[model samples]
Target: MSLDKGGKNMGRMKISVAAVFMCTFIISAVPASAGTSGRSVETTLQSDLAGSLNPEGLLLTVGGYRRWISGMNEEYGIPSSYVQSGAMLGVSPAYSHVSAHVEWKPVILAQVRLQYTLFRYFGDFGALLSFPSKDSPFGKDEVDAREGQEEKDWGQRYLLQPTLTAKAGPIIIRNQSDAAYFTYNGAGPYFLEWEYDTLVKDGGWVVSNRTFLLWEAWKGPGKAALLAGTVYEITRSFSADLTRRRIGAVAVWTPAEGDGLFQKPRIYSQVGVNLEDRNRDGEVYFIIGAGFDHDL
Candidate 1:
């Protein structure tokens, strides 16, 4: 296969089983406590959506994440949610410092995302067109915004993530970091990820640019669920041209009703680590984050 063609399908197949795994998380939030009932209608919408089918509403991932941006510039945020390890080498582990809660209404899915990478704040608001499981592009030819070159590295990252979902699985296409260099210049690096899953619990496999096989336990009760993944991570220092390698793991915790998007009191938190990569080198990371899910 050609280099360009090969890079598109690098890992995570067409729909990155991992992405599909997180995409379907359903949150069953507890009913709002006494008081705070007569607030605004907007508040009510946020609240109803909170305990709805996607606990991802108002996601705050905190722990730690590191990225070698350019040759000499490196960013490591210990308590931020939107951690950007800068697509290190091949695989870069990230702790969600800031995440958005996804709300799906029959046909359209809306999202509100917030992220803090180090000191930089990134927020997102958008919508996605949903598809049936029989038409998704699980493994196809597309560039990886993170692993490959065309991906927008730095600066504003805004785009609609058009996904294909089918009985075979799903595929996602988008940019990498919100870097202006690639985004403004139209360098692209648009990547594709794919995965195949089933209604059966723990019956799916995920593929992405940096990681190999990943699986999930589909059945759950709490808004909080456990997701695990294995990866070969790559770290590149933009200024130094220094490179680092490590074996990594990804854990995502999504809860709801804390910040109460509907104006109810709801809190959110997330923590994760790439254990082996840092090893005893102290290159490890920890991300701690929290936030509110609001709507108008």
Candidate 2:
């Protein structure tokens, strides 16, 4: 029935984009006035982790991310499935992580970005580590980072993101984490240019479930994008009402899967790499991905 009416309109567009991102994060978690946050519209607040994605400041990219959501059904903690959704949202797979900042857009729809996020669950990345700039970049360093102590076994929470993206038609949505629910939400890393991963434990090895949907477009014969989604396994995180479903159908043509590749059949290319995995029992789960966008 037209592919089950497009998975019931992608689960009502993931519950209306999670109810408009939880009603604009509960009205910016309330508390404004510094002249209404120095004239609101400051990318919706929270950014400046030593901002710099390179506009000839050098250091093209310095990104970090660790996404692990579990719940193949937690025995009785709550979340029915997917390693009990990260141990029933205690979330702390290496402190469930994300860190990135990028720069370089002197031209072409112009680019400039500042970012902040510490994942709201327990809260504290110091709002992307506030920086009013002395041309900051964690400069004037003392270097002291002692988070909630997590190497990984369990415990995690965070989804603050920032985003900015430009490229009309073909569609693109950038939100870039103001703690927006995991996995590098939106274009915080300047619509990013590199992402990688690999994980294969051994609960026997691979059961399975997954989902992802993406639509990104960048100009020129040099840039390309598209990742029509599916595969649903984003366990849980401080839920009152959050639901996602797909568990399959992550299509990628990558502009020609080979034999003299490209002339057509792309879904974002630069030697593509997109592999998503999910498991949560016996000890075998996954999220191995890869990305590298280019424009010289």
Candidate 3:
């Protein structure tokens, strides 16, 4: 491994350590609700740590990025210069076997996603639906427009994304497609609303394969430590181009106890390297995020 590879590995380790510290410090500093036994609370907390499998809780997380890029692939369809400093706000509320998730990148992009677990075999298999911002910053026909230029009059877009997910043991896999329709700005006849366009027009559908394995590294009742091995992704879009491949690790810490803001909190840190693409060299992006989990 080169120096960059070594540094990236260290970054992943740091995130794991930080998660452990966060779980310990928060649980110790916050008080639990009165009258509920510790064992009872821990049992309830266990469900929240099961990721989307449990499927019943409120999750809120906010974080800022040194580099913020829109679209599925880093800068595939968007201008590289437009990727700038930004903050992301995400909320996911799960009820029964269904969950609704929303993520906003302010003016950059926004997406609303719905996930439903149709059944559970060895593990859980589900369907996911997403509506994302599809309008180009500039008019679609303006091939010469510069990046970040706000369009005074342009067509708006509505996109629907559907995905299939399979989770078994520690492994998870997802397959998805993005379908979109466009309507001219402020147009009334609304005839355009009836027709749709595919962003990946050249190809029938954009296909991506994502896989990851998560394991419990350590646990003590309400508090637990986790480590993950991820293929992160190797995206093959409709354009017949490979976006970028990532292979990395993630560390997480979840305390089954509540802080004032949330009854259960999860802290995660991930470090991954983008494999060198024809257009850009490989780089490492380290992300650390914390979120509260509350049962409704």
Task: Report the poorest 10 consecutive residues by lDDT, candidate 3.
Answer: 120-129
Q: RMSD for each model, in Å, please?
A: 19.4, 23.6, 18.4
Pick by lDDT: which candidate is best?
Answer: 3
Model 3 per-residue lDDT tens digits across residues 1-296: 12142222221111111122223222221223333232211111111221110111122333322323332212212211222232223222211121222222223122222221111111111001111222321111221122222122333333344434333443433333434333333322211111111122211233433444555455444443354444355544333233446565666666665555476667765567767433223756455566554433
> How do these models rank on TM-score, best leading?
3, 1, 2
What overall lDDT, based on C-alpha atoms, would model 1 receive against the true structure? Answer: 0.23
lDDT ranking, best first: 3, 1, 2
Clash pairs, candidate 3, are 258-263
lDDT of each: 0.23, 0.22, 0.31
Query: How much is the lDDT of residue 206 in candidate 3?
Result: 37
Q: What is the lDDT of candidate 3?
A: 0.31
The deviation in Å at residue 120 for candidate 3 is 35
Q: Write the per-residue lDDT of candidate 2 for residues 99-209, one digit (tens) a residue.
A: 343322332222233332233222221112222222222211111132222112211223223323332344322233223222322212211001101111111111112
Q: Which candidate comes out best when scored by TM-score?
A: 3
Residues 185-294, model 1: lDDT tens digits:
12212211101111101111111123222333232332333334443434332221223344544433344334433322223222233332211232343222222233
